[model samples]
Target: MHMKAIQFDSPFNIKIKEYKTPTIGKYSLLVKVAYCGICGTDIHIYEGKVPFVTYPIIPGHEFSGTIKAVGSKVTRFSIGEKVAINPNFSCKDYGYDHHEYCYYCKKNRPHFCINWEAIGVTMNGGFSEFIVCPNTSAFKVPKEVSLKEAALMEPIACCLHGLQQIRIRPENTVLVIGAGPIGLMMVSLIEAFYKSKIIVSEPHPSRRNLAIQFGADIAIDPNNEVLKDVIKKETNNYGVDVSIEAVGGTTTAIEAIDCLNRGGKALLFGVSMPEDTINLNLFELYSKELSLFGSFTNPHENDQALEILKNKLINVSELVSHIFPIWKLEEGLKLMKNKAKDVKKILIQIEDNPKEYSEV
Candidate 1:
């Protein structure tokens, strides 16, 4: 069967093209894509900034879909079920020759697999009307979760992994240094899971206001206001216990380090360019006993992300500021790539209504 899909031929080249939709294998399920989210990585791919991405790929790693058909041997998932996708490619798939080859996968950290290739970046992904993937990549979407919010599962899972790395304690002060979707997710996750005082530093006034509305205790305009002064005043000059650099810039990384207290943890959650580098004070890092962690991708955090969405613990719906149909994929990507715009999450709706296409 042929289906309409958005294909990225090369840098700055994207178009809606008709491609053959694969039939499900014994271990695979055919999914009718509901929504695919535009992420920073997608923007990077469009700008030719990401190094590992190959050309002529479908660029959508964060997505939600419904089971349209199931293979004969697929027992875990049934038709009519809604699901979220995990795009990380591991060595546990068909043939499975590299069982002991990768140290990270052997240690139960497939997110750091040696030969990892993602669905959207390196392989055919979910920016289409239909997708057939291994049942392992599909997680059952919770009943209370909306299809639109389910599209955000992959990113939420990534942010959850970042949260695990820094280990925010109750009553601790956290400074999140961006107000984009991922940064705002950090604020909301900290508010819901950490239950701590949160401060946000965003240059955009609209985003700073959003940070406050999304549960930040204080929001500072870094361009116009002194972020260091605000943090000192809020923490009584002690500094924050945890600092998350979500802007993926050298200046924000430096700011995050400067605002951290002694023995504080820093979680670098943003995707930086290959040429980007930040100068850090090695003496201070050693003297203060600071810990630094880098979050690469989503681990086994999709289920928890779905649970949070199902229970309404995090307001992901509020982060969704715009939606576009599949035909308007390029327009959505352009809007998401615009830094001046107050856009959070931009979703490409492949189908009008999931229920109409589902067997249920």
Candidate 2:
């Protein structure tokens, strides 16, 4: 069988091409994709930032689908089971050093998997109608969670894992720099987990407004007059208890550091560009005993992300402001790259809704 998938052949060159069905490895299973969420990494690659993106490589990682087939050696899943996927598949077969990074695999801290190889980056992913993955990589979606919502597992896992790196108390004041999708997710996650007031700092008015909708008590534009004064007032002049930098810009990174309260924690959750560093006051980092969290990709937090969606703990639905059909793949990429108006959760439709296409 032939599968049509979106792939990058080179810089500024994406194509919807056909490829032969991938053979199921001894531990792998085949899946029929239901939804593939367009992520920020996909846009980064489009802008020529990634290094290992060989020409003609499939790029989707956040997705949910149904099992269609399983390898003869596989027993954990059967055909027809609906599921969402955890994109990170580790090479335990490679070495024990990988376990140091495995938060759960090492000390039963399942939220932090130290040694993991992501599906889309290490191999082709679900930007197609069908793809094959190990049972270990595919997870069962709950009855209450829609496939569209389950498609956010990868990113949700990311924020959840980052949150695990630092413990936030109910009385703590939190701030997030950048109101992009990740920043917005951080806001929702923190609000859902803590009783403290939440604030967001974003330059874009549209995004700042959206932050308010997503649970940020205060959304400030850095360009706004009295921005610093407002942030200081919000924290009662002690600064925020914790600040997360979700936009990977030097300016925003510095802002997060500056906005923290004494002994505050600043988590760098964004994928910063190479060679970009923010100037900081070493004296403050020492006198205040600031903690820095450097987060990179999802580890072992996919399940909590799913639970948040399953229980409707966070108002994630409002974040889905854009959706597109499969044939309009380029349009979706363009929408994200241009940072179009009121854009969040750029979902790529894989199958025609049977209700719309008419059931056979």
Q: Evaluated with lDDT, which candidate comes out highest? A: 1
After TM-score superposition, what is the CA distance of residue 204 in candidate 2 from its true location, in Å? 2.1
Candidate 1 ranges with C-alpha deviation above 4 Å: 95-101, 353-360
- Candidate 1 per-residue lDDT, tens place, 119-202, comes to 888888888889888887889998898888999999999999999988899889999999998899889998998789999999
What does the lDDT read for residue 54 in candidate 2? Answer: 61
68-160 per-residue lDDT for model 2 (tens digits): 898887787888888898876654322346434455565654334545556666568778889888777777889999888888888988998
How far out, in Å, is residue 339 in model 2?
2.3
Error of 1 at 265 (Å): 1.0
Error of 1 at 334 (Å): 2.2
